[model samples]
Target: MALNFYGLDLIVASNIGTIKHVKYNSNPNKKPDIKQLQRIKELEKGQGITCMTWADAEQTKFIVGRKDRTVQTFNLITDEFSDTKSVDFGEGKLQSVSVFGESIFGAVESGVIKIWKSNTSDEHLLNTGGPIEKMKHCSYNSSIIATGGKENDLKLWDLEKRTTTFHAKNVPHDWLQLRVPIWVSDICFLPENNGNVVAVCSRYGAVRLYDARAQRRPVCNVDFKDQAGSCISLGHYDKHVIVGTGRGLLNLVDLRKKGKLSKSYKGAVGAITDVMSQKDANVVVSTSLDRHLRIHNAESKEIILKQYLTSKLTCFLLRTVDSFIKQEDGEITIKQEIDDSEIKDEDEPDQEYDEMFDNMEIIREGISSKIEKNIFLEDKTKDVTVSKKKMKSEAKKRKGNDTINDASISEDLIDSPKKAKLDKEEEKVNDEDIDQSIIKLLRSTEKLKRKLLSKNKKKKAKSLFYK
Candidate 1:
């Protein structure tokens, strides 16, 4: 869940417990190596590490939020640890943490958002809301913070003013009580001069672009055919916004023009739990409930690297530096792969299996009926033609026979009503005989018909074309 930048020699907080040190190389020309640089020592006791924020450039000092409702600081240079400094905010758990300059901000489970300065004093600058679901620092302006949660409310707060700058309300409320809150999944400010623009995604499969400077509503919105599960995680690199959904889909939104879907990558087989962008912005990494860590090239949508992990990653942060570190001997050790085998198996019964079987049965029955109808129609046509030819030949034969026989015999044969009735009955019998033959063939060769039908299906499939 943590992103390590080799260039900056920094490792941000990830959800895999406490990973205080990273092994890396110093020189690009030499073989890769590992260095045991320790950042936090107290994390060895299995204290829950929920979120991390770097306070300095060297990444020597940082703050981490733990499950015990405490925030602790660690200094890498001195290899020292500080005990939790409790901030009184009722009883809700802290879900997210961020740093803007010397001030620190945390979003709690009770929907309350709080901020404190770097001096580590008992005083806090701002404490707002009951508990915040998600929070992020504004990219362009460090003074602004965006917060959202179960209430479907998005608030933009200005640290200087100590108040909300803009409050956007009435977000979709469906699925709010779901496993993952269906409110605002994630909100991110675009990079560079596009500070006024922000993208917000909801759990109801909606991605909307809003202009903070505009007086009206959002400029554009997309629903992805209403299939994007829930927008749980989001990242921004230049003009593109990458969104991770509950269904484990990584969607790329192009904001350069009006908002448009550029591409979508299969993030993982399970729900996407977290996503991070590398310092280069050309690549993105995501973690899923499927216990997979996937890295993708932003432009090509090609997976550059995929590693299986044992645990479901809950959160991830990328250090804003290259992934290479230098050593005295000019050796480099690439970032160590995270082992995610800690995730337990939680497969549930598939609910769609019965419906799928029913659909298949219906299709099979339709095909069988169509085949029977076609065979019956073809036999009836052939029998009618054969009967007409036979009748014409018998009439010609009778005429020739009569011309050679005596005139009295011909008159007697013509006057015989019983014979005429018998001829009519014979025609009816022939019709019934043809129908019985067709029925017998259909019943006796059912298995053969099935085989032929299968073969015809294969042939038709081969002839079908798909774009």
Candidate 2:
């Protein structure tokens, strides 16, 4: 009630007088989140809230009815309670509240309607009954109201005329020809219906739509399977009304003439206490004794948001406009819901980022694939050694060459056995300056062998031995 919602917009009140504002997630895959929560400090330990309604369209002021048998006016702007329009009914708790024609009305379960800001001496209007279960102020006509309760059938009242305009008769009979006891738990006036069409839910799981201008009995009748229907709500464009049951069931029911029931929204684990639908969208919200507030996409029958409020939610109000509702100036308007498939592309890639990606270099191959081309797998890896047979073959071919010296051929032959395992770089020694003496030849051979042994230690010392 904290300037939270004007209707189907936001703000839920729990049994302990705590108000919470929640935001809906249009994506069914993600959960809804709670935005704010506040407890009414003035409400004491023993009091119980029975009713809540916006006192003005600006959402600056609101009304609260408590089990203490008092109806109080609260100001959202000042965040305080005012005594000007507050009233102590002195009996039963108020079940319904309405602000219309510049007067405030508090209707009690005892069939008494207390009118504030009245010019007449008689401030309280009485129905010819002792108790009423539910009462709804007509949306299309502020002067008209609808009421129903235990043993009391649905009735429409004209506040200006101070008379009952229509009374609904009991359902004719069952297949067994027995009576269907009356126990209407909640009533909702259909939008744009001139206050003549209403949707009602009974404690016996019956959902009935009444067209006052057409007939006294219900025009369309449907039963909620295995769950007692407790509350109902209608939206501006909805061909159906969302119904809440005593056992935590919420579903849209096509209750017009030639209508059928819609799919069920699954989540709550306790009795549903209240339900509301956004006027312009297929978004519906419900509260249950399970302490959870759930919003559903009525068209797809999916839950858009589910938030735990930490208290048994009894009732809530929301605006049909966006979350930034101008609650203080007039009725807070809630924004329309966006479907998941039709969500805006707000998360699209940035233009600069796309340009950077397009400008990046594209490599033909990865480094891993070229591990052996210009790179080696390990640091210890070396080239393949030349075969000893290949060295002998090359030396034989060079010995037969025309410009070779006999002494040079002898030096090469002397070195071939020791240098057989050497690499090509180590085999390039210049022996053209040899003296051709046997002692000199043996000395040169020893020097060449020592140098080759020091350079390529990978070949064992014995492999370089002169045989």
Candidate 3:
């Protein structure tokens, strides 16, 4: 259900089966030793890893929501499993579970949300409402929960009050018999703010920021050209807000400057299943249905690292903490054995590293040709400088021609035949000049094409010589 990466260790949540201990940076394709594979096989049985969270380095707790509407919690430190606790909610499966302080919240399929106090018996905080699609805790306080549901509504709930604090509704209307409406996909609270403003995304390709304290209206909405998929994840660092949509698109929006999308990264071939931001905010890791985990520089939107996986990663968590040891003799000792099976082989070397560096010279000649191709494909209307220069040149030519025509007409007005002959000659010359201008433009384009071809041929020759 979830994989939590802490330092160099990977804590996997196997809902009902045993938890897997894997190296954080290991490769999935690498073969494990006999004993390690056997251990992994044991953990892969039954309902599989459900959901796991680290209570500490020595302890972890995971909940397995079984098909029979039962939940079981396993303590990894004690190796003791709790008795199966049957969920009182009618015959629906548990969709998601979250732990906050001393409480656990479960979103069930029966359109009901249940809460249980960890210290007390497995009882519900409020057995109200239908199934919630997604739920998240406000970063500022764990007591507040944000829920989105099938009804296309976002509700803010206060645990202490045990009631709804604020609700935003999406209503449908019919104009000319067209039913148009909005549906909430995901919601997140901005960092450092006490749930004062929340960013909500919808399936209709719009992301909106709402102020809970203000009237029931959105502060700003951003519309994208593509239809966003179901999942929407948000990460905030300083004034930058990183948003990931289900359509495998990543956007960085600056809160300080409204209505501006600063950077975007496009790499995921399929829907993005989850996104986890590093504590430093410079790097963000995302998993998609394409079975790849990609790391991107949040500021530059460039891919730094990409790891291929065997399975689609559903959820992931990252945390930074102190190293798990004290410096006694200027050395750090780890109690657990290092699992080297996870480190994958680097992509096959096409050539020796030094040889490849030397061979890169072949691409240098081709770069200019590629650049020209890109420029030609780009929107010409956006070339402000070129358009301005063309306009100025045309204006000066028009002024000179007007003065010439005026002087010729004034001097030849007395003689009708001579004036008529002069007029005809001038018209022919004017037409020739117009034709030459058109021909000159065409020839310039042809010259660029020939230059591009020459550069490409040289690059090809260089490539073959290197081979």
Candidate 4:
């Protein structure tokens, strides 16, 4: 994704062997217009794009790791894809690729990690371990990278020092005494934490937060409880994390609240494969195995836009910029919208099947009128009550003490079981009516005899001394 002087543009690399370019419409007056996304160009990659990262500081060139065990660079200026560069790490499948300053880092399924010097083709093999599925370079410090996977756990490496910086320790066993499995599917470094904090979601259904400087264990851990966490994306709020689950459930978790689930979004029909949030925490884009992409309002927990794509989307990046237009000499053209009266019914398209985003106007009154509703019941302090003597006198006039309702029963009496008076209508039972216990007295006697015999033998052996 490049958001330089050329305007904000997103380069979407899909697993379906296609790379699409979407440019943000640069119309200032149309800022609030829903058509912020415009398809620019699309090219067939022939091979599925596995991983990608910016290859240069200018954001003009981006390197894409492919399923063919090779990396290719796409130049935004030229709009051309470069020839594939071979990965020598046992030709394993590329799991992730990251660019750090003047070097390119890649992790493969064969447990090989390599970094190539940006200026030359000189490849340097770093440390190797279990298959890595996710590798993210720190946003603030490009020299730091975080890697995690099944059995691999979370580990941080510093390219500058050429050594492992942090080694994550597995979380302790749960209350059930079962070891928690480590299968980190997605990871994101906290942008506001100066690279000291990172959040990761595991296929084992947990969102864990780690503070590298604190301890090896996660500072906070939360489980989805219903479905495995498929992917995770950081929200606009520093402590907020948006996680997509295997059950198509989207949950917003707040780290400050002990990683409690703050809100949930519905509408996905299949397992959520990827999730990415716009700069606005309120807007979230998600892709699911249902072959659809959906944009949701995080606060409302409602889907605002949904589109059925041609193939399953493995990942996506949303690049947004400040109002796309650059002002000129005071004169501005305002595109007027067609009045509802002018649009004839016959000219209107069938919108029942239209899945495109619609421009709608929303008027916000105030926060109190919106999300902050009456969280508590009306106060009982204003309620009036009759005197105990008055109530008792009224009850007596109704029908003596028998008039008391079940709700008025004393707490002690309610707790105690009442003795039932057997009448002629009540059924009587004899000893035969009850079922006897199934335990056999003979079996118990035999078991007791065996235990006694063993105990006697052990006592005699102890008496004979330590031979």
Question: How many steric overlaps are in each model, in order?
Answer: 34, 16, 12, 0
Q: For each candidate in turn, give its C-alpha RMSD to the true structure in angstroms.
A: 17.0, 20.1, 20.0, 21.9
Off by over 4 Å in 4: 1-9, 23-46, 321-467
For residues 1-467, could you state the per-residue lDDT of candidate 2 as single tens digits?
Answer: 32222224466777776565554544445444453334455458645667788877756567777666666676654556774344555356678887877777877777777776745555756573657878888878988888888888888888888789998988888899999888999998877778888888888988888888889888988876677888888743455877888778777787656667767788889998988876455567788999878777766767766777766788887754333434436655554445546644331213334566899999856665335432532321222122334445665566455235434566665477654444333334412222233345456546655665565564454475832
Candidate with better lDDT, 1 vs 3: 1
How would you encode candidate 1's per-residue C-alpha lDDT over 1-467 as one tens digit per residue? 23343321333243535432322222344322212223233345445566676765545566778776678776654656653576567556677777767767787777666677756763454555644667777767888887776654567788777787776644344466534233676777766533566677777676776667773355666666655544433444456677788778888777665677777888488887767665444567776777666778766888765644334455544455433332336654444433324323222212233455667733455557567867866775676567657756765676566456535466778678986687668667766765676566555556555776797787678884621
TM per model?
0.57, 0.63, 0.57, 0.62
lDDT rank, highest first? 2, 4, 1, 3
Better of 1 and 4 by lDDT: 4
Clash count, candidate 2: 16
For candidate 3, lDDT tens digit of each residue in 1-467? 12323232333332333333333432344422210111333333345433334433323445555444656665544555654566676535665566666666776655577788756875665533645656666758778878765654677888777798877744335457775456666677877678767777677776777778885556666767675745555654654555667768877765553555777778988776666666443567776667666778776778765655444445544434323333348875644433355544343221233455886745555556477686883543245346556655765686588668767676547356876677568767766775666666656666767887897787888896755
Candidate 2 Cα lDDT to native: 0.68
* Best prediction by TM-score: 2
Q: Please identify which of the two predictions, 2 or 4, would achieve the higher TM-score against the true structure.
A: 2
Name the weakest run of 10 consecutive residues (lDDT summed) in model 2: 377-386
Give me the displacement of residue 25 in model 3, in angstroms: 6.3
At residue 21, what lDDT does model 1 achieve? 39
- Give candidate 2's TM-score: 0.63
